[model samples]
Target: MSAQFSLDNAQKDGNEPIWTVTQLNSRVGRLLEASFSRIWLRGEVSNFTQAASGHWYFSIKDERAAVRAVMFRGRAQAVGFVPRSGERFEFRVTVSLYEPRGDYQVQVDSMRRAGLGDLHEAFLRLKQKLEAEGLFDPERKRTPVQMPQRIGVVTSLAAAALRDVLTALQRRAPHVPVVVYPAPVQGADAPAALVEALQTAGQRAEVDTLLLVRGGGSLEDLWAFNDEALARAIAASPIPVICGVGHETDFTIADFVADLRAPTPTAAAELACRPRADCLQAVDAAFNALTLRQMRLLERASLRLDRARAGLVSPRQRLAQQAERLAALRQRLDQAAARSLERGVGRHATLAARLERCRPQVAQHQRRLTELGLSLQRTLEITLQQRRQKLAALTQMLEALGPNSVLERGYSLTRNAEGKIIKNGLDLKVGETLQIEFGRGSAQTQVLATHGLL
Candidate 1:
């Protein structure tokens, strides 16, 4: 059907243009849609119905007026809860008119319980804020005590959560003592009371593990656990806290800040301590292992002892053995001494015979020495005569080559004042004193002139 339509197109008797019911309803619906975009409406639900096709048909009304609404399956599926009669809700819808019945209605895009939207928004805002502060950091979270000595519970005494926790602890860890710090789990004063209880448990420092627990409820009922002060208290607790608030699907700020989050109160108690039977079994196993190890060590020590006993000897017997060894050594020493003395005597006799054989003939040597002396004298006399003859010849040659001989041959040696013999006229300096040496004597003179010999 075309959205653009005009009553002027069809005329009746030219009196007045008229529109069909379909045309009128379509035009009115379009006008309503154009006038208002999607809007949020708050009213109590009435005459709610769900079709097989998963569409929701309902009526929303205040005290004086009511409006019919329909939500398609796609949008209805996104809504978390079913709409019930008499329940207030906020709907995001478009105003429209049904063409078939010409009835006015709203096409709902989404819906939620009236007040829950605000609560959810607050929850999200707090979650985001705390997450920004690292309260939800996994690294900062502590591991719950595996075997707590004592467990503390922070819950109202009359609460079902307290009963569940106590029952669980009794079943899993009866040996572990449980201390309950009474506090209100819900109501306006619950947050403060819960904070006080947690702070008290922390101050006492009596328990290694603490359980912050509450039964499942609506968001408003569980809002106490979402308080900022309560979350900060849980984070500041020295003891490891296991927060069990509401059901598994329910989450509060306490759960994020706690050291551990349990899906239920019973789970928190179970996680706080180990089972007593399991602990006993572990202890027994360790004892058995230690006993077996000790037995093995003892057996090894026994074997060593037995060996030592077998090798042990009495002091007297040990001394007798030492004496026998000494006797044998003494006999061996005596034999060695006797053999050494005999060898020494034999060596001495052999050396004495060698000395006799090597003895010098001193008397014969003395006679030989006298003979050698006479021979040496004769040789000395011959050598002296030869030396004397050679000496006389050398003397004659020397006398022939001597300056005195030259002087006797009518030659003279001239010497300068420095007593240096002048062999040539070039050696004579004018006006220099000279000494003339002849065979008979040396005379001092002065030279006035010099001449060169060719």
Candidate 2:
């Protein structure tokens, strides 16, 4: 007799020695397929090979666990991506049992640079979303000032990062004021806190610009900077925002969208300060340049004054020329006075004789009187005729041409369908339609006859 047997999912789980080879293989294969399909494993590559059929076979193992993975030719070709040996990555895998071989393995679907690795997966997802929206475009970023009068900082006041910024600003340029707004640098509430502090600094009239900063840590540690709201706020800030979120290699959305980005809080502080040394040097150079320029200007002005004095003309000579012109003008006047005396006397005699011969005043007066009489007579006749017989004649002509007058004269005025009076009888044929109007009534009629003028 067979002893009672039970099989678990493990190697000894089944009591199926009586089963056929093909049937056992099919059952085992299906079991392996369903088991492997849902696994996600992180591993280092080992014994990786690509067959001539374009299928990839590899073993994934670390210190603790080892698994066989097969990436089929179809899946392999679609990946367009190949991972080399010794590279550590997480792959989405599917397990399937091959019926013929009765073997089990995983199939890789797709992968990226381990996007979900210790980094904030959600943060990376948001980053890619905003990046595609072009918020991270370099063109949108404004250049930070080489020297700022007042540096505005939005960060936790209690954090060491704030003290580091203050120290660096003091070291570089102690004269410039530092405006600090307390903000939450990390956690669920950090994003809102950072945005408010940024807005506060921007709202202040005294603040020259902004520094959105936090100390370095894990990706999740500095996630406040990656907040979409904070990124958009920094981008829209009236003051330029210089982001100093974390270490050099660490990237955040704020770093990309800010007006400027620094690798650390201290670097951002150094960037914002207008150093005493640079200022002193610039002042000295300016003074020297100004002194040289002033000397040249003074010399040029002195030379101009000297040349003007040497070339100056005397007022007495100008007055003498005017006196000579007056003397010549007086002599010409005397000569003209003598000629006028002789010419005036002769002109007086000639005028006296001409006035007697021509009597122009009498002739002009008579011609005016004659013109007045003829104009009055013509106007009077025209006005009388227009008020009497001519007005009656125009009235009679209007009455005779009236449509009712012609219709009442025993002649019917025929019009076309458009109500336009027919002027020529030939305008309508016998079969064409016509509208005939008598004195009191109108009727539609067909053109029955045609006639021509003799």
Candidate 3:
């Protein structure tokens, strides 16, 4: 009998213990969990699938074997990038067993691209070292030459990059001279050869700008440009260096340390030498502008000259015109004097008539003023007397309503300690504090006993 069948048989016989399929699977899962908590697995991924419930299923494989794996939605969402088939990665996972099928698998937690770890670490280390030494400071970078008189190239003569650069330079600035300092741009000896070429070019001082260029390639193929020695050499060169080592996305240590970085060798040449056609166009435009300005200036000068010529006159003519103006001014002054004399006489006669008319009115106004003054004095005296009488009546009314008047009439006022007037004796308790007011004085007292209630 099979083990499962025999276990059932034993359970029926009641001679030995038996385990169900569920129990067996549960025990195996517990054992797996107990034995292996978490592990790091390095492998290539394949057969990846994302379920509707957002769970990820895949297999990780190496040369010899493969194992199924899954990443639940929660953990998978934590990954920064999506995973694809056939990509190698290092995964942090937990060993697990699916109970229903009794299948072994790993639950992945996180992942990172494989093979890049060591290279990335090394790249970072060198970058940090150079940056700490101030090799990448903006202040240390040399200013790029605007239009170089001569450009020296440091690259392999066999490289396509060389042809691209030469073609660009020929097309852009044929007037500028180019010197090729041939050097290997790949393999083991490239860094050393490049350094030697740069040093030689520096010593010669035949070029104002230097271009270090190479075609695009894989990171490993372009590793020579990442060399620390190469970077330092580029930084130390007296001639401004423009590095175009790879495509736009590829960055190397030389790119950081060089005076300027271009996307490709052709671009570097274009930068170092401006286009001849563009220069000619600019010169033409400037000449046309200057010519127009000169023409406008000449026209303005001519207009001014014409105006000046038109205004020219003899000294005698100017003197005759001034004499005419002086005669007119003298006539106007004489006319004004005569009119002033006539107006003064007329004003004196009018004033005499007005004085005669106003004399009688003035006397009549004086009599009316005297009458008003007497009336005002009588009214003020009567008002003063009436005010005195009203004040006396008001004083008498106030005295009748005042508490002092009541006190003077043989009545005493009682107030509590809080200054509240007491209206009835029954409102007070024995030993309560009170104040008694009389006409002339006041006294503090205590309620010794109760009185009759109203």
Candidate 4:
């Protein structure tokens, strides 16, 4: 009976296939991964460990439950911050089972501090949308007034930001007027309240510059400034806006849309109004510069006047000077005439001595004159003969080139009625009168017909 029972049990067990530990765990992991895609989980970090391989092993727990999580080296390196125990974080993970131990765990893909992931995502989305629309263009931003006559601040009157701005303004410029446009700086209704306050200030147009400021706070605390409507209101304001919405590291849509962004509320106030002492100093400098310039101009004019005065002369003194100049000119002219007379006398004596030294013998000069006269007559006779020969050749050549020479060659010259010599038959008209000249004489004739050479 025992053998029969054993056989029966073995046969029953043989109907089902057996799975090993590794195979079971692997199948379970695959099922878990397929069942749940990547998901976000928020919990406090515990037992956070960074392994020698740079992988992260940690447990994420809430008050009631906990789950094991592992981030590989590649994923952990991109998380930017090291996970510390007890710090809450939102993790994007994929559910899986550790096949080696068959332990349930999640593979972390990415993580961020709690409450920041969604808000940051929304922030980036809106920023991208507005940027695409050109709302954050640098070209559209106005230049903030260097010195506003009446400054307007928009913030909750009870808030510390308002107090900070007021203190800074009073310290920097007590004489300048300050107007407060109160609005809530935080909470659900804060965005609308801020927009309304901005519109009110803009409609009034009383202030040359407007300050939209708030104190430093966390991103969640300062989320009101990131509203789309508030950003648009700031951009549309008639007066230039100086936005100091958060600490230097904090930024919002309002900061990008405003005319100027200040790191703090006090900085916004300081930017809006120059210090009273600085203004006075500037004015004093300009006045001193003007005074110096005027003094220089006056000195230049006075110098010119002194020069003119020095150049002026009394009429009696002028006449004495003119008389002296005329007397000097008369003495110079007499000296020049005396020099000229002496030079002329010297020249005449030199010529007379040269004439005496070069005295000619009359007989010899007469003989030479006669010989020259004879030579001149002979040269004249030869020149006349050569001139006659050249004239004859030229006359003969002229005669050969003359119109009579062509007429003697059996060609007659014809002149039209207008006295123009007709060189072409085309110039002749049948009814036109023509003068035909032979070598001897010219006769008047009328053309009966014309034949074209062509």
Candidate 5:
């Protein structure tokens, strides 16, 4: 006989179950994935491990329960920071069952550090929203009353922060009056109560300044002060607000929107009220400063007056000195003028004497000139007679030495046909032409024969 067995999500093949453990786990994974598509879970990390494959395996747990989780390498790379043991974190994940061990686990998609969780994220979002709207602008923050006559406080009456602010104001400024507007300082309703208290104090307008005070706590505990509506109300308040929420290290939206932010509740009160003794001391210092400045100015003026007095001179004395100098100059001028006139007179007399001595003797010069002319005439006549006698003697001598004169004395002159004188008979050639001249006439002849003069 054949028996049929039943199994979950198993297909029957001819009365035999065909589903493997792996197939079962895969179907369960698909169902879980479809049931919870993406889920956010917040818990602390434990038993964390990073495999050589770069995949992360860890367990996330709250105080009571824990779940196994795995982040693949590709998704883990985008997580921005590494997951560590014992760190509180939040993640969005999908559920799946590992087929090998039938273990249920989650596949993490993304994660973040959960130091303050959603409250911190909400706080940042609201802060950024208000900042973009210019609510946190430094220029819009009003200056608080340095010395307020009446101080308004917004806080829980049961809170220790209220007592602290009152004690500080009493110690610093006992004369200043205190008005309290009580409100819850935590939980969901706290933000609206705080905003209403701010409105009430602003409407009254009796308080010179308003103080928003609260004690220090974690980000979640102080989140009420980070409310968006409360921040706007504080910014719109007619009186300037001093915010003293949380500790020195803590900050909230109210602190940023308030005109002044103190480190503590007592500090906020002290800031609004100045001590009487300190005020008196400041007034005294100002008065002393003014008096000192006035004295310095007066001393400078007195020194100027003294300097002017020392530089003073009498007008009459100056005029008398100028007159004496003028008289001396006039005496020198008179001496120079007299000396110039005497020199002029001497020069005129000298020029006149020289003119008289320079007169010309015209008659004597003419007689002497006439005597020189007669002597020159006599000497010229005598020289001319002597020259004539000498010239006649030279003419006679010249005539006596003439060749015609020699020819006239019974001598003859002979010449060749070329007119050359024939000095010797040898100079004539036979049958050559010659000419002979007596003192009175001349004849041509032929050298028919030669004769010796010897």
Candidate 6:
């Protein structure tokens, strides 16, 4: 018999072990716990909850099955991470039986979102924590490189990001030197690799600015840059970093944490490196401006020198010359006064003779006006008499045509009930009402007959 336990009552007394389910589980759990103390699991997260005790209760599941998991507040707080529902997640967990319930389960240690769960979650957490610490505030963000001395790139040795950056540098900034710190730009090892490379670049005193760059990739591929550790590294770096990761739309933790975010790797390269062509053009313009300014300044200096020379005569000598000029002006003034007096006397005599010749014409105009006034008086009297006769004729014509004039002739005006005037008997209906206006009174009557004949 191969190591069989004896069933005979006395033979199995001391070493005989009968296990309760709990006991069996505890033993098996201990073994599993030991074997899987640290393990990694990947699956979509579900049934997630945080307890009052600050612990997480959840399940990690695939289409076929699921495993119950819990992260105690101690471990959870240590990492300070949680996953949202329906998101793919991965983490290091321990396989064990909960000693109290004797239930088998996994105890989660560290966690992250679907493929990008870890990096993205870390990025968010750091962003929030640092923001609370005020690291990412506008005040904290470093201004971009308008001019950079030496450009240092942190990217993989074999990467399209490097090639593109080099190509752009060659085209835009041929003269500037580039130093690259090779890194593992993809896969599980990338996050740690990136952090180390950043540290290496940070220690160097020569690197003026840092460019943390990488080629485009899916969320999983770019997850390395989203690490909180890397973000903190970027924030703490004395050298400002310009991040160019993936396409314009792709954003990572490093993007927010870095000093600047360039949409493309080539763009970041151009930003860090200096352009020889632009430098040359700037130099030429500055030289031309300086040459022109120097020429103008020299011309101004020569003009000032000439004016200085002209004003250089002794002050006492200049005063004596001014006195002589004033004496000559006084002599010229007295001569001008004598000539003005002679001209004034001749003008007065000529004006007197012209006045005597004009007096006779004035008397002739007065006589002609008196004769025209007398003829106007006769015309006014005849016009008034004619107007009076016309007024008397118009008054007689008005008395003949007026309605009141006809009433005075003993004719009455008759009207129908509707206030319409009755001009003919044909217009009246028998038994219809009528109103009549007489010379002294008015009367109302009914129509006795309808007759057209007068």
lDDT per residue as tens, model 1, 320-413: 9999999999999999999999999999999999999999999999999999999999999999999999999999999999878889988988
| lDDT per residue (tens digit) for residues 326-398 in model 4 | 9999999999999999999999999999999999799999999999999999999999999999999999999
Worst 10 residues of 3 by lDDT: 1-10
TM-score per model over all chains: 0.50, 0.48, 0.45, 0.46, 0.43, 0.44
The alpha-carbon root-mean-square deviation between model 3 and the true structure, to one decimal in Å, is 19.2
Taken over the whole model, the C-alpha lDDT of each candidate is: 0.89, 0.80, 0.88, 0.88, 0.88, 0.81
Model 6 C-alpha lDDT per residue in residues 295-375, reported as the tens digit of each score: 999999999999999889998899999999999998898888888888888888888888787657767778877777877
- The whole-model C-alpha lDDT of candidate 5 against the native structure comes to 0.88
Which pairs of residues clash in candidate 6, taking residues 3 or more apart in a chain or in different chains? Answer: 88-114, 112-117, 112-118, 113-117
- lDDT score of model 3? 0.88
Who wins the TM-score comparison? 1
Report RMSD for candidate 6. Answer: 13.0
Clashes of each: 0, 6, 0, 0, 0, 4
Instruction: List where candidate 1 sits over 4 angstroms from the true fold.
Output: 1-40, 43-88, 91-115, 318-454
Q: lDDT winner between 1 and 3, please give it.
A: 1
How many steric clashes does model 2 contain?
6
lDDT of candidate 2 over 1-454, digit per residue (tens): 1234333432554544455566667766666656566577787666779999998888777667777888878877876667665556777887666667766567777544553332355666888988898888888877767677787888998888899999988888888888888988988899998888888777775677688778887655776787899988888788888888888888888988888889998888877756779988998999999999999999999999999999887899879988999999999999999999999999999999999988668888999999999999999999998799988998899999997898788878778888898998877788788888898898988877899888
| Candidate 5 residue lDDT tens string, 1-454 | 2334467756656566777877768777777887777799898787889999989999988778899999999999998877665567988999888878989899999998886434566778988999999998999998887778799999999999999999988888888899999999998899999999999998999899998999987665788998889999998999999999988999999999999999999899889978868877898999999999999999999999999999887999879988999999999999999999999999999999999999878999899999999999999999999999999999999999988899889999888989999888887789999888999988998888998976
Candidate 3 lDDT for residue 99: 94
**Per-residue lDDT of model 3, residues 316-434, tens digit only:** 99999999999999999999999999999999999999998877677889999999999999999999999999999999999998988888998998999999999988899999999
Model 4 lDDT, residue 204, Cα: 95
Off by over 4 Å in 3: 1-121, 127-146, 156-164, 179-208, 215-222, 233-240, 246-251, 313-410, 415-420, 424-454
- Model 4 TM-score on a 0 to 1 scale: 0.46
